[model samples]
Target: MALDGQNVCRHHGGNAPQSLRAGERRVTEERARVLVETYGRKIETTAAEALLDEVQWTAGHVAWLRERVQEIESEAAVAATDREHPLVWGVTREKSGGEDRGTTEEAAPNVWLKLYQQERTHLVKVCSEAIRAGIEERRIKLAEQQGVLVAQAIRAILGDLDLTVEQQARVPEVVPRHLRALAS
Candidate 1:
């Protein structure tokens, strides 16, 4: 592509070496600024808040996978009738070619169960990274900091939102159960 605000093509190296470096630096900076503005406008969360969000998100996902795994196992215990459960949840590759094939074998529930367990394990590992990083935020390991962080995050969220009376009531019953998953 042509260089921005310049006559030469970017890939052809027609510009002098020093000018090319300066131009590349300008482009890089401008791109970074645009990205910051766009992302900042969209979410506006600090790094700490982002990590906290990721922890909650991963914990919620792990909770869902646990329930799904139990259901799959329960189904497997009885009869082996259904077989269309996906190998990967939320994604399936399409054949992209011409006509659809009529006959195709499907994965059994045990396979899906194992996949869900693996996903939950991976998600726990992801949350552990966030937890460990939080523990190290002070340059010394503070194993109990996860609880404090969770408490602080909850306080921050509840403090910021104007919840209805019902919503406020629900927080006590709801938040602790999901937060409990992080300990596991």
Candidate 2:
């Protein structure tokens, strides 16, 4: 579940080419708006607005995660270079219970690695949940809108005739084959 650089790259669509400048590769506001509009057409305005809001929050969260990951890695690198014991082994000095201080240099690399991986896993889970919630919200909103549209369309199609309210309500349930074909 732990996310590595590969996972980050995958979620981002792919790793940016090394030669591409950050400014060159960044998505412009206009481009983002066009993309939202393109996808927005499939759903109602409420859903689109919700998606846009979720996207903004997700962007900020992702930025923070990236920064935190960088900080952790940088700290590890500095510790490895500056201390006699590498970060993989253990901390240079560890505080124990009852105000006792101890050097945990005997710790295995896997222990530190597991802690690092756990952090990444937690981040990945947070990211996944945020995205999943957004998708679910959009899906529910779109389905609700579609249901309303269908009802309105059916009412309009049956409205011109001299049918009672009861008959109009039953129109969808007993729609004629010809009418269904025409609608389709």
Candidate 3:
């Protein structure tokens, strides 16, 4: 395979890419060991790193999406507020004055529903990518667990590892706390 802009021992079927620096090797080994401990079973270094990368990337994307959704909701709420125009038409105002607050409250559910749909759509996109990458059914199932709740989805993904207490304590420092909580 290619590594650092050069091909490694491709003819010899060398699995280790030639580009790994000393520090990266240490980090990779630590991550691989953590994966094995987390799953209570042996896992190849490459595969472990790949799984960790996937989980991290998915979590990051979901977090970004959630933040964006919140921003969108804020915008929506502000937009839902009734603004007065100099040229008033058939608009009616209650004797109490001010726009109808109930209209804004009624829209809150729809805003939540729209955000939920966006999250679900993003999850399906991730799942499809996993399928295309030829991930196993177990991994696919884990990927699909990503839903509206970011922490809960991460917890569900790590739950599949079934890490023992000792192993859980040995989880890699690189792993986020939300994911580590699953093992706990």
Candidate 4:
């Protein structure tokens, strides 16, 4: 049957047809509300799951890195031990012949000091060489610049004398000996 806006449904006794325009509007509104709620819940759930996974992965990586760091530290400590001879912190003479007992810490500082001194010596030599090279390069550049300035001064003198190119080139040969010596 063709149902209008106020038409009543047969199944609901006196209730209006849910398929009518007004009824459809209410249904559409409810459907939209449901969709928004479901979509929001799914988004929140996915974000929460991703965050948890990231936290788990980061914790695992940090734990692994920590273990590796500890292992490296232990290896370094063992390698730092001096294998030359047993240290003698104090001497003990009993029924036994002789025994030396001490911590290896005393020799470590001396070894490190020698290494530092050698490194300082190397650094000084390198720095000195670098400075010397820089000074030499600067001297060379300055000499070249001075030569250019001298040449320009000579050209200006020739120009002031109103000399042509040919005259300028021959002035040295035509000048008196005393004048040439004074110019030189």
Candidate 5:
């Protein structure tokens, strides 16, 4: 569908009514064309940098949490073995019949299981928090980059229009009589 000044201007009907002059409208259209042509390349570079920053920030936190969980698991395994072979680890006592022997085999305690589970849960929480923080940081960076890209595009457009100021100032004189009548 085609858009016209009437439709575009309707949004600001109540406050400080304003309209784009013919030359200004041409310049604005040129600016929009330039932005469309150049914005993607600029945004792509910015987004890549933002993503890298986020990855760098999160990598260390993730590695530390993984190492901690691995340590916890190793300790839990050792504790389980100790519970099963108390004599093997020198924790057994001799029986009353003067026979040197080991104690009955017992299953690993529930406390060890609980501790392992808790440590695993904490590790997951830490990893998740790191990921969320990374994502948030990346989003912030991307938003900032997008703002810079937009501003750069505007400046570029202004610069191009500035170079054509003299030529653009002569457009109204070339306007057709029919178009001028319609404007009136």
Candidate 6:
């Protein structure tokens, strides 16, 4: 496969005339088909810098959306002062063809109200997702802190116990295996 100008792989035809880069490998369609059937597709997400940039951009976008929600000049509360034209209408049309079918039209409230609610609902969901991501990040950080303390305590205890050299030789191999979960 080849990485091309549009990020498309050459296996499916690259965006432009292309050639593989120095360390690039190609997978045959037959091998790829079998691999995909068993384990799904191979995709890339190994770029940590890209993920960080995306997170920053999303956070900025959320703040901007929040400000837009607050900064909107609402005409919702203001009563209609124009008495000259009162033929206000909200039209909805539906059609059905069957023995017992009828029109399915609905009369919704003002479009502005619907938009306001939709925007606010979207904001709530995005805020919730951001909050959960933050909490997971913090939880991982705390676990790392605790893992360090545990390692230190284990070392200190080993020092206090005055174990034999043969016994000391076994600790390094055993400790890391047990502390693996906390490292993440």
If both were scored by lDDT, which would come out higher, candidate 2 or candidate 5? Answer: 2
Model 3 backbone overlap count: 0
Model 1's number of clashes is 0
Model 3, residue pairs in steric clash? none
Question: Best candidate, lDDT-wise?
Answer: 1
Q: At residue 103, what lDDT does model 3 achieve?
A: 24
- How far does residue 46 in candidate 3 sit from its true spot (Å)? 1.0
Q: Which stretches in model 3 have alpha-carbon errors above 4 Å?
A: 1-45, 81-184
Give the RMSD in angstroms, all C-alphas superposed, for model 3. 22.8
For model 1, where is the 10-residue window of minimal lDDT? 84-93
Q: Rate the local accuracy (lDDT) of all candidates.
A: 0.68, 0.59, 0.56, 0.54, 0.54, 0.57
Model 1 C-alpha lDDT per residue in residues 1-184, reported as the tens digit of each score: 6676345775676377866777778788989899998876566877666776776777787788778777755665565544443332323334556687344444434455666677778777766877777734642435467667869999899989989998999998889888777657
* Candidate 3 worst ten-residue window by lDDT: 85-94
Ranking by lDDT: 1, 2, 6, 3, 5, 4
Clash count for each candidate, listed in order shown: 0, 0, 0, 0, 0, 0
TM-scores of the candidates in the order shown: 0.37, 0.26, 0.25, 0.23, 0.21, 0.30
Q: Give candidate 1's whole-model lDDT.
A: 0.68
Q: Give one digit per residue, the lDDT tens place, for model 6 in 1-74.
A: 44632346756556434434321334455466778899856466544433444556666666665555444323
lDDT of 2 by residue, 59-163 (tens): 665566666556756876776754433434555467776656776565444344455566566556655765766775766789789878877886786777879
Clashing residue pairs for model 2: none
Weakest 10 consecutive residues of candidate 5 by summed lDDT: 85-94
After superposing candidate 4 on the true structure, give the runs of residues whose Cα lies further than 4 Å from its correct spot.
Answer: 1-133, 164-166, 171-184
Best by TM-score: 1
Tens-digit lDDT string for candidate 3 (1-184): 4443234543543344444564357667878888888877844677545655565666676677667667755765676734431112222332444563422212123444455566667666766666666666665577666533765764676689898987677555535664558657
Candidate 5: misplaced stretches above 4 Å?
A: 1-45, 81-184
